[model samples]
Target: MKFFRLIICLSIICGVGSSTYAQKNFAKEADHAFFNESYFSAIEAYKKADVKAKPAEKARINYQIGECYRLMVDPAQAETFYAKAIKLKYASTNPDVLFRMADVLKQQGNYKEAQDYYEQFLSKKPGVAEAEAGLESCKKAQVWKAEPTKHIVQNEIQLNTESYDYAPAWGDKKHETLIFSSSRPGSTGDGIDDRTGESYMDLWITTRDNKGKWGEPQILPETINTEDNEGGAYMNRKGDALYFTRCPREKKTNIGCDIFYSEPQGRSWKEATKIVLKPEGADSLSCGHPTLDRKEDYMIFASDLPGGQGGKDLWITEWDKSEKKWGTPKNLGPKINTSGDEMFPHLTDEGVLYFSSNGHVGMGGLDIFRAEETGEMQWGNVENLRYPINSSEHDYGIIFEKNSDDKRGFFTSSRPEGKGRDDLYSFNLPEIKFILEVYVKNKETQEPLAGVEITLVGSDGSQVVKTTDEEGKFIYDENGSDRYIKKETSYNIEVSKDEFLGAKSKFSTVGEENSKKYIEELFMQPASKDVVIDFPEVQYAYDKHELLVDDRINSEDSLDYLYQTLVDNPTIVIELQAHTDCRGSDKYNKALSQRRAQSCVDYLISKGIPADRMVPAGYGETTPRAPGLECETIENMATNEEKEVAHQKNRRTQFRVLSFDYKPSGSGGE
Candidate 1:
């Protein structure tokens, strides 16, 4: 009774009625229409044959009716016929019937009943992956409904008709023009498609008004819109090339759809030519829903060709630029695809791939999911976009705005309360703005320093370079000329000027609530010789000369700063100055200080700094950090706590720049 089994069980069951001639005639007509993809005509014929059908013929007739409704995407009607077929025990060996029934129930939002049918199907056929996914989706559907996303979806009424109008694509970089496929009135051909019982689809173009309202929908020129069913339009990032689907009607069933492309001719498009992504003479196979990567070097599409995972697996092919030809098609593999259909792939500029899949565990029907490309031609961590972005209807063909950071886009959906069989809906995440304003200043004079180059590097691999304006400030926000910084991403800000020392700092928008403006001041010191900085205490155990464990550059640890400073100022040479308290013997303290200073130098050398760039000196118990402390004797200190504090200050390490020029052994210049 299931769709796949119906192909194998094509032979009709004979009727044991007195009027066998009429019963057989009606059943024969229905089978002919069904085989030719004329589900509308087949549904009518099957109903007429139902009355005269025998007990055995009844189940097959009901199952055929269910198939017609399912293909039409009418789950409510399909559920009724499938239930009847199940009650009659039609094709009891085919567990696909139970699974199909469960699928329809899920689409209708009856999760409990759908779960029951999924369990029944799984009981007979254990380890069925699709059935297991269906059960999991039912549970997730309930949870998703309870906590839906903040996306407020609106049906674009002006551009829609009382027919299938979907698969919207932005025709311009600014998204001022829109192009989509529609099977509404005034198509190229007056003929109706047997698949959907509607007029053949055609590409339509529309424009958005200055007030953000859609204008009248107009059919594209005859160059692109032909007598055949042409739709599923996708354009390259530059908007110079457009790829679409063309399903030419055949004598029997339609010659399977193939992907075709057209070049822009001024403001309009020229006649389309087939891309020939697959091997020659594979006319029976269907390919559609083309998506080109940001670089336009590779394209992914949905195809029902042979040697796929199953029905309509997503396949990719590289575009040979110099040769100007498409390479062989390759499947996306099992992680992103399944036995069920996967289509409508959209690869974002950020390398995040979004596609629609029925095989993946989702609410029901085709749900939109996104996956980050982990490596070359590899994708994982698939996540369903969740409702109300995806619904229990066929939601697909999403298109995002060019250079958009706020996640604004339009998608096609057939959910109820729409103006047509399928309508376009606009969605955008609520923009939470965070502004960063950084001011560069002189460390010694506290005067603002203008024209300082500030470079921001993000954890997401985003880098922006800017110079401080006359106000000695660089500002970044959602409305800035530069790329917007996203939330939950840490960024490192590096500031430098001609005569000033380079400075580095970091900030993050993680866990920030409400829109806030952050003001930060970065002070740069003069890059001169013998520049000393008071450093952190190198906490060594009692009488110990070795460095502590966990030697990393962090808030608590400052030893790595010695290495980083050398890296930042690559040509600069420095000396490690180590000191100790007055508690120990002078000679012993000197030995300990020397070892500590050598430890600092060794750490720097291990980090790839040349040994000649650093010099170690021990000023043990000789130069006290607290100049006011009378260190002639330990008893001369004010109190025990005061003496301990002074000693703690004295038992520290500092570095002073020796020279700004230090050449490597083979690099020549000094």
Candidate 2:
């Protein structure tokens, strides 16, 4: 439900009056008030008439009361009356009650039940676009509220009241002064509005202090606030020109609301002028919720004028420099307008248009949607801002905290969590957090290795060096202060210990939109050349030198560890050695082992590693992984399985560091 920014003059088809109470004084008065848009007065009259009326009369009266509340932006009470009328079988006479009930239910965020009611209405009257759109909205809104955006929404308690208060806009370029509409107790308008039962809305202002605290609210001067509906104001980027809505006190007529313009004079604004928008003789058409583009070359406003998509459509009018007035209004087309009401259009300085609509597929009621101007006036990618920025109620009239920072702002919402029927809520998008926890451990011992030097290098040309603590844990994050890992960036994590070979892995935030915590467990091997690191899984095809590549496994991939090791420790040269079982002659086995080692060296060379960085070596089966488990000893064993195990351990692919200095050809240093 919405209040100030809501389109109140949209065509509403009232339920048929009961023949039993058609001539009665209470029922007659209620009908007259309802037809004249005095919904608050009509509801009171309808309730009194319902007290003594028959069941059929009572059903219609209750339904009418529900309609009043719905228009007045009170979904809870509207739902109550609509459910009562439906229980009395009013829906059987008028199936539109189902649609009305669904609307109110959705506004309350009971999306599943609302969809059911919408489907029921659709079955009764197939192909109703409004009902179809509502049904789709129910389903879509459920997902939006379930996985809302990063925006954190909180009711601006200092600026809200139990009465209607909404549609906040920045009153100053600095964004320190906030101007919003409130129908609280101290509004300048006197007496109750027969339409809303609250004092006619007035613009109010509150200033945020230098300490970033918002001060108490104060109403605008009398020049702007009249004994009429006045709210939903927007200021140009210059902050000098003010555009606001004004619904004059015509309780029983559809004379229509209009937009007004005012200029600031010292602490107060000058007398406002009614901005003539509609065509001549279209005085019955209502137009309000005025907003201007950043350049002030164009104005977008909500209106029920002709040539729109439907209900109330957002229209744009270009400023005519020659005529010193705005040109004829042009509809924003189906891309922006829909068959349902679209109101409260606000265009940011960045050409992003934000508005609220019941038309587009939404979470519920009036959901906030944004569109970017693609061409001269064409727009695309009309996306919902999503919940909690958009709840299952009337949410509209959004304004950012400043032109530069879009993620923080104030907007209107009639969702139940607010302090009023429609309250102003401050919203902000929290920064996405990226953290990397590096746990260094010894490869041979599998124990935590402390005091290891950790170097994090980012592709964004940022690097940070941190040492592992006594726990062998280095928490590498922004730490809520200094950020090294950032969006659209890749980082290399290098861990080096005094006696261990450096280990490196890649961690990136690129293509990742959500906050993430990386738990990287790095194992560093002892750097001594005697510590032979074996690749047992990497085997050859039964005496052939080529690396194995088959469906079961690709042994070539296992060598990537050595490939990365050579790349990480660029200055180190490695001896890629291969061994064999003593099944063949010593000379033949040595030649075969040499080819196998060269095959691995060739594979690394194809992956961009320099060939000179590796030296291939083949050792005939002279060494055994198990100290004395030689082939002759394996032959003495009783079981044939024991001999094969000894032979398999002898056949292996292993490597060792040759030197720690490997200068490139162009380097002069040796």
Candidate 3:
């Protein structure tokens, strides 16, 4: 009986082995067809293997079929196969299969379900950073609002899509004509893009008629557009000048873009000239998407210089109308930049900056963000535009429509329903709301003084309590809570620090005013000090050394303080030193420093300081308070910068009291 049972088992095993061999042959053919790009044939071969294959083998066959369908762009069919394979539980224990399922769910925009699979995959593979990033993105997507279905447009005004229209920019002045870049068939340069096989992009203009309709769009003449790619345009308020980016491709090398500007002539634009704000050796560095302030004196653009934090960063340069050139560009720094690409900067009349970035947590690829200019060359922290506007796709090139009532704007995206590549979409931004922050510091040392308390007592006797951070910074929300109606309330801010005089300041904003943004910074003083002296404000001549006659040698404010200092210390000997910024000849600067020092001494004598007790000296451009400092003198700098800041640092007067000994009237003194 045992021998008979063994013979029967052997016969059954042989039958099972024969079936597996046949199934393996079918899977091999399917994989070969898939590798050859014959996806349809691979699917048919896979179906044949599925019938004879066991549970695990069948699941593997289905996964391969799903991959082929995904590569063929049939995501729905691929999703179906992945779901079937998952149900079979062959790869339910493997993280790779779970990740594939999550990716398909994400492509379908079912973020909630995708998130579940992503979490499971991450649970199995504990240290996958990309999986974590995707999980966060899905979480954001789950809560994000859907894009608005209705367009916000004025009555009878329609967006013109007659030709290939995109990349719109507004002049500095309000209600001026709209300038855009297009690749219409009638453009002058009949050549096509080597990569896309489409017409090259060039700048175009469309004027606004009295009826508020855009007139026919026309390509800028040959002198301005050129045969190369010319886009990313900006115009001055007067419309007399224009700045744009031009990328002229050289045969095989990947030449980067540069900024150029053209002045308007009687009817047409003159020949465009290259603006060299970057150093000569760094021509390979890219600088584009420039936006000038209303005055056209300041410009902000983007560059990918080596020293930047990472990727492309924003930079600014000032226009020197006298030199007919641009000053050196300075990076906007870490506050506005991250380790991701930031581009498309747009400056508003209200000093609000609109730019796009991929660094910040966003709905997707690139999100439009806003920042306010806090100081002369500094910007506040950036805030994302947030839901409905940004999506998990490449969204960029945002610009506001001029003279529109609804605050409607246009931006580009490569989202699902677009006409191949990127398409322009219109959106209306919500009302402007912000949080105002104030920072206080010691003027002398520029160090943050903490433990300072401030009370915000409104005019209505309603108190909103707050305190400063360890860094002497305080934040106030402009839009208060729902129950607290925001109104124009005068705030009596009482500030106090240890061992220092207490001070009070007041501020109130007009109610329902949405046009302007406001910020105030205050510097406080210590209660007492041993000696106090005021320095005279210095002035300089333009490219010359002769001081103006009417100019007072000593300011009354300085003289008053000097007299008080002498009265407080009757027998004090003082020394005054003068310095000059790094400009002009070294010997000439030394002589000028000496003359300036003597001038101070003469002024002190006129104020009744004993001449015998005073010493005057000059240091010229040496002994700088801030060493190796960039941005000082306009001339003799390493870079081609017109050193405005260097000059300011150089023109200063410093004083030191040498001795303070007085003789007693009735007693002998040695």
Candidate 4:
């Protein structure tokens, strides 16, 4: 069986498989085992059925075999059978073959082909949020794999076998011993799990020696590791109490899994007892993957019981000290749960929750996710650990370093790179370095401008200043031991020089997964007092003062340069002067020009620029440039096009600094 199903305690309806009849005994048995969730046995039965089946029945058998492998989490074999079933066109009864094929492909990081398959599935069934989410996950998976986080992951080959060895938990506060679940050769169970075709899982222990190498594996005593399936294990803060999932093997029975707690006593554990998370006689609903907080006041586990959003959800129940029982189980809410299975919950002592889910957008079958507590018993901000930590395979049951500041730990994965089917791995995030390299250039000449002051203001309320070198470059890597640029913060950059108009830009490190070097080149317009700067094709309506705003031209947005100038150079004040062509009356032109200048000031004020710093000056057509191109001597111009060009130039808008000493109130700048 797939680990996702097993983690939920091998849950399936007990007798549903027995009720189905088929034309062939093998076919009937295969269908029976499948509905019972015995995927491993179902695969063999279906293959046997395929030998004597007709064309249509053989196609259906192939599809059934694909379903068996898919549920067993064998994506490679599942894809093989699914591809065969698709070619056989058994799609009428198994409409999900395309989707399942895409899912398995995506689980193996074959994103491009998986995308094509997901699109094909969507073509047949439109608006399926799951398929759309899968498509989106494929897009993000490629990028995430290419630029993974600083977390380094290494397979624990010493503790692994060719079988499934995963779900490791730290057994001691010193982080030396490990208590994990495995289905290797030394398992107590004599019979194979019909679900997984492997030995029943058992809780195993291994300790670290002085050299830090894990010692040989040893099974827990009969008090914990029963002949039946034993699943994930976690320890309490004191390391005395151990909680693990146990699924008692019963022939054709729906004895769903439950969590059991055992306390260390000498060489053995006190008689293990089940933690009752379900209602009276709800044996069909599985409850496992138990985790607890530091105080052990409450326990969170995965369950498929009713009242969940869908499938398995993470549920919490506090310890009622007075009643000596767990309080009524409460769902962790839809934010942490989804319509798909959510399993293998692990909680840090500091209350950070980690779990695996296929319902949430992920790279593959099961991706590890993290959520933070928003309030008392509330959780939000569900984030994916992404890429190396969560691959295109099943990744679940992560244990931290009893962590707060420490971000390294052990987790489980069924990725192809592992030594076993599902292997334990260690992970740690290296120091993430962020370097910001800025170059200042002259806007008019495109030449590097040295001696430009670069002021960086961070969202954390940190301000730092640096000047450009002879190469017009300023590097902001760190301030002594502290990095100037940090994760999840935004920074505003102000570039200024004595003879240049101040320029402003912004850079944010939010959601950046990898260490990177950010290069920014801010061009400064040379301006002392009277320098003309052109706008980006600002268009205005005839006569009226309101600026034109459209797809092609935005007059107000064109004034943002002046807005930034005032913002970056807070001590400077400037005049926003407007002009009119010589065609209009001098009085009318003057009035219109004055209104246009005020309109610019009004727009700047809306952008949080102080009105006092910008003065409106209307020159009208009184001061036209050049002697020959003037309308007063119109005959001097060669053509009407030439004359109109000069007229358009005369009707322009520009700004000039009035004073560099006009500081705003409560400000200190020179």
Cα TM-score per model = 0.63, 0.83, 0.47, 0.66
Task: Please report, in order, the local distance difference test score of every candidate based on alpha carbons.
Answer: 0.79, 0.83, 0.64, 0.83
Per-residue lDDT value at 307 in model 4: 95
Query: In candidate 3, what residue range of length 10 has the lowest lDDT sum?
Result: 5-14
Q: Which is the winner by lDDT between candidate 1 and candidate 4? A: 4
Lowest-lDDT window of 10 residues in candidate 2? 10-19
Pairs of residues at least 3 apart in sequence or in different chains that clash in candidate 3? 632-646, 633-643, 633-646, 634-642, 634-643
lDDT of 4 by residue, 1-670 (tens): 5343566444533334433555468888888788788787778778988888898888888878887777777889988988888888876666688898899999989999999999989888989888999999999999999988778899998999988888888788888889998889878868666677777778899998999799999998888888877877888868889998887756566788888999989878998999888899888788888888888899898898899988889999999999998988999988999888898888776677889999898889889999998998778899999988999988888887644254788888889988978899998888778999999999998999999889999998999999999999989887797899999889999888886778878999999877999899999887777685555544468787788887877887778867766777787788888888888799999998899888888899999988899899888888675566467676467788887888877778888787777767778755
lDDT of 1 by residue, 93-170 (tens): 567889999999998889999999999999999899999999999999989988998777888888888888888887
Candidate 2 residue lDDT tens string, 1-670 = 2253245463222223333354567988898777766687788789889989999999999999998888877888999999999999998999999999999999888999999999999989999989998998888887777777788899888778898888888888888998888888887867776666677678999998898788999999988988776887888778899998887744234467788899999978999998888999977787888888878999998999999998899999899999988888999999999888899888887788999898898877788899988898667789989888888888888988764368888888888877877888888888888888999998899889999999999898988999998888988666456676788999999987654779888978999978999999999887677778775467788878888899987888889978878887888888898989989899988999999999999999999999999999999687776776787788897888988888888888899887777898898985
Q: How does candidate 1 fare on TM-score?
A: 0.63
RMSD of each: 11.0, 5.2, 27.7, 10.5
Tens digits of per-residue lDDT, candidate 3, 383-426, equal: 76755566655456677766554278776554555553344566
Off by over 4 Å in 4: 2-4, 12-24, 402-406, 433-670
The residue ranges of model 3 lying beyond 4 angstroms of the native Cα positions read 1-134, 146-164, 320-324, 401-406, 417-421, 429-670
